[model samples]
Target: MSTVNILHMKQGDGEMSYAKNSTIQMRWMNMALPIVKNTIKEMLTIHLTSFEKLESFKIVDIGCGSGPNTLLFMSEIIDTFYNLSNQNNHQSPEISIVLNDLYKNDFNNIFNALPLFYEQLKEKYGHEFSQRCFISVVASSFYERLLPSKSLHFVHSSSSLHWLSQVPENLDNKGHIYMAKDCLPIVFDAYKNQFNKDFYSFLNKRSQEIFPKGKMILTLLGRSIPEPSSNDGCCLWELLAQSLLDMVSQGLVKKEDVDSFNLPFYTPYCDEVKEIVMKENSFDLDKIEVYMCNWDPNDDEDDDNNIFDKKKSGENIVKRIRVVSESMLVTHFGELPLDTVFKIFAERVANHLEMEKTKYTNLTICLKKK
Candidate 1:
C-alpha cells in the first residue's frame, strides 16, 4: 500500500489517545518505560559509543513514547562529559536533542512534563546546561518526516515499528472461506509489505539525511527463527482472535468478518530486516545480533498470577496457550470493561490449552550508516 493510503488507514483506527489522565495506559507505560530505557542505555554503551572524547551531538528517539528514553540518554551524555572533567575541574560538553513521533501524539502532556524535566537539569548543572541543550518535539512518521538526515548522531526506537499502515491487501478479511489456513500467510504478507514500503523509505530517506558514520539503534518485535507459519510465536494474539470468534458466536459480529479481520500489527524476522537494510547499500551492517527477550514470568506471584494459577491444570494449559491472547487482550481490550472480559478470555484460554502451546521472543537490530 502507498504511504498515503497507509496513513489514511491508520486514521480509521481512531486517534491515538494522548490524554494525560489516561489510567490503564499509564499503568502499561509504567511497566514498559524503565525496561526500554535500560535497554537503550545498554545498547549505547556496547555498540554506539566507541571513544571517550566528545563533540557536539545530536540525538533522536523515534516513536519516543513519553520521552523517558530521550531524557535518559541526554542525562547520560552530560554526565559522561561531567565525570570525565570532574577529576580535572574542567568544562562539560554540549548536546542538542530532538524527539519525534506522529503529529497526533499527545504533545500537551509532553510539553507540560518537559519544562519540569528541563528545570531540574538546569538547576544542578548551572546556566550552561540550558545553552548547550535543546529538546523539541517533531511531528512526523518514522517512515517519513525526520529533519535533515545526516544531521543526527544517534537515533533510537523501541517497540513501535511492528504497526503498519493497515492490514495487507491480499489478506483483507472482507470475507473468506478457508481463513484458518489462509490467515497466517495473509498476516505475514501484510507485515512484510508494510516493512518493505516503510523501511525502504526509511532507509532511502536516512541515507540522504544521516552523515557518514552515523548510527541507528532500533529495538522492535521480530520473529525469533523465521518461521514462515508462526506469528512471532504469539499464541496470545491467536487466542484474542478466538475471543473475537466467541464474540461472533454470541452475535457480536459476523464469522466472515472475523476471518477477514487481520491484525494491524507485524513483527519482522531478523533476516528479513537485514535484507532490507543491506539492500539499501547506504548502511553497512555494523553488527546485527538477534537475542530472545522473555517478557513472561513463570511464577504465580501477583493478582495477575493468581488468575493464572487458580485454574485446573487442564484450564491452566489454556491460559498458557493464550499468553499471546492475553497480550492482545491487553493491547486492545485493556481499557474496555476488562473486569468481566478478562475472566471470560482467561477461561477460554485455559480450555484451549489442550490444543497448543505458545511463547514470544523479541529481536533487536543495531546498524550504522555507510
Candidate 2:
C-alpha cells in the first residue's frame, strides 16, 4: 500500500496516541519557534499592510497530526498576529488556518478539540481575535497539491517531510527497512532517487499554491554526515531492523516478510536537501540549519552517577517510535507481533544507547516561493 493510504500518526489522546507520545515533536516545534515567529512577523509586516485589500490571511501547517501541537501552532500564529495588530493599531485580517495531513490522520480529534482550542484562544486574545480566526483540515499528502493556486501565505511543517510518498521501488537491501552500513549501493541509489523525486514533486506542487514571496518553514529528520548509512543518521532504523531479524531467528516472523518490508522514509543530508531545493528551482532557500537531538530527549532522570537506565530510556524511545510507526508495522507484520517486536526493538535501542548516545539530526529550512 502507498504511504498515503497507510501512514498516519497514532490517533486520539490515549496513552498510545501520537498526541500522548509526541514530546520529541513538541521539542522540535519549540526549537523552530524563533523561525516561525520571525517568519510570521516578517510576512505580516509586508503582507498585512494592505489588509483592506485582502480577504483573509491563509496559513497552513502541513502534516499537522492530531492534538496539542497542532493547536499550539494555531495559538502561536494568532498570538503573533495579535501582537502585530496591537502595535500598528491595524485590525487583524480574517485569519484562515488549514491543517494538512495524510488521509488517514485523525482529523476528528482536531475538529473535536476546536471548541476548547477556540475557547482558549478567546481567553488569551479576546473574542474579537478569536472570532476572526477560522480553522479547517485537509486530509492529503503534502507531496501532492492540497490547496488552490496562490492561496497560502505561509506553510509550516515540523518533523514530517522525511516520509516519502512510498517506499522506493524494487528495493533489495535484504532484511533491512532502511539504508544500512553495508547495504548494496543500489539500495542507496534507490532511496536517494526516491527522495529526490518526492521532494521535487512536493516543491513543484507547493509552488503552485503559495504566492510569490510566501514563506515555508520545514523541520524534518536529516543528517549532517555525508554518508547515508552513518550510524548517527540511520541508527534507529538499524536497531529496528536488528529487532526484526531477532524475531526471524525465533521463527516468530517470516524472513521473507522482513525482507520485503521497507519503510517509506528517508533522512537526507543538509547538502542533499539544498541540492534538491536548488534543482527544483521553485523556492529560494532562505536558511537551513541542522541540529542533533537525543533519541530520548526526556532522559534527564538519570542518577548523579550517570548510570544508563536501559529500561527507562528504552521505554521512552519505544513510546515515540511506536506512536509514529505502529500503523505501518502492524500493517506489514500483523497485529500479533506489535508488542513483541517493539519490546525487542526497545531493548536493542537501549543496548545501543548504553554503548553510545544516539542522536538524530534534524534539518530546519526556511523557503520562499519564487
Candidate 3:
C-alpha cells in the first residue's frame, strides 16, 4: 500500500484516536527533548554575534503528527528563543514553525488547538512573545522537498521515518505482514534496499532545504544489534502476523489475504543509519545513541510485583500498537475482524512479556548540515 494514503494517526479524540492512545509516543518525544534543547542552544551560540541583525528563525518538525507533541515542541522552541533574546538584550526574531506530515494527517486537529496553544504561550512568555511566533502546516511526504532551498535553521522528527513510502514491489513473504523469523533472505534484502532508497531521498531533500551548520535531530525505532531480524525490532509485527494467522485457521480471514499483506516499515541498527548518512555526503553525523525502552514504561509498579499482570500489560501494549497500525489494518483487511485480531494480539504479546520483558531500542541521532 502507498503510505501516503494509509499512514496517518487515528483522527479525532475518540477512544481509539491516536490523540488518546499515544502515551508511548509522548515518552519518545520526552526522550528526544534534551537533544533538541542542546541543538537549539548550539545554534544560538553559533549565531549570537548576529542576533541583533537577524530577521527570522525558521524551525520545522517533520512528521509532527497530532496536537500533543507538536504543541509541546513548539512551546519548547519558543521558550528557548525567548530566553536567548532576554540574555542578549535583543528582540526575539520572528519565529516561523512549519509542521510537516503526510497529506492525510489531521491538520484540522492542530489548527483547532491553536487558540489554546497561543493562550498558554501568552501566559508563559507574554503576549508580545506569542505574537512573534508564526505557525503553519505543510501537508506532504518528507521523501520530497517541502521547503525553500536553504530556508530552514533547525529540523526535528520523533517516532517517525521508519515507514517506507510503500511496500516493496513483488514481496513474497507469505503469511507475514513484516519480516518474520522464518522469512527468506530475499525478504530481508527487499526491506533493507527500500529503506536505503527512501532514506537517501529524505537526506537529499533535507540537504537542500537546511542551511549550512543547521542542526537536525531524529528519533525512530531502531535496533542495537547489527542483524536486521532482531526481535526487538520485528517482534510486534511477528505477533500481529500470528494473530491474523490464527483467524485464518478459523475461516475468519482468507489465507491469501494474510500472505499478501505487508507492512511498509523497517527498523535499522544505529550503524546502518550512520553508514547511510555518511554515504549520502550531505550531513555530518554528530551523535547516534540508542536507548532501550520497555514495552510499557508506565508499568513501573508492576515490575516489582511477584506475579506479573499479563492481561493488564497485554492490553496496554495492544492499545499502543493499534493506535498506529489500526488504520492501515482496517483499510486492507476490513473492520469485521479488527477487534478480535487485537484481542488475540494482546494475549500473544502479554505471554511474551511475561516470560521476558522486551524493550524497543530507540535511536536518537543528531546531524549538522555541511
The sequence of per-residue lDDT tens digits that candidate 1 reaches over residues 316-358 is 4444434323433445433444334445666665555444434
Kindly report the root-mean-square deviation of model 1 from the true structure over all alpha carbons. 8.0
TM-score of each: 0.70, 0.90, 0.91
Off by over 4 Å in 2: 1-21, 46-55, 300-308
Candidate 2: tens digits of C-alpha lDDT, residues 1-370 = 0000101121121112222346887788788888888877766557433433444666666667766777776677678778877887877777777776666667898889999888998898898888988887766666767677776666776776677778888888897889999899999999999989988887888788777777788888898788999887788998898899998999888999889988877899989989999999989999997888878887653447555687888888987888777877777777447788889988998888889887878888889888
Which residue segments of model 1 deviate by more than 4 Å?
A: 1-55, 67-74, 84-90, 123-127, 174-187, 256-260, 295-341, 348-357
C-alpha RMSD of candidate 3: 5.6
Error of 3 at 31 (Å): 1.2
TM-score of 2: 0.90
TM-score of 1: 0.70
Number of the candidate with higher lDDT, 2 or 3: 3
Ranking by TM-score: 3, 2, 1
Q: Give the number of the best model, judged by lDDT.
A: 3
Candidate 3 accuracy as TM-score: 0.91
The C-alpha local distance difference test score for the whole of candidate 1 amounts to: 0.51
Which window of 10 residues has the lowest lDDT sum in candidate 2? 1-10
Candidate 3 overall Cα lDDT vs. reference? 0.76
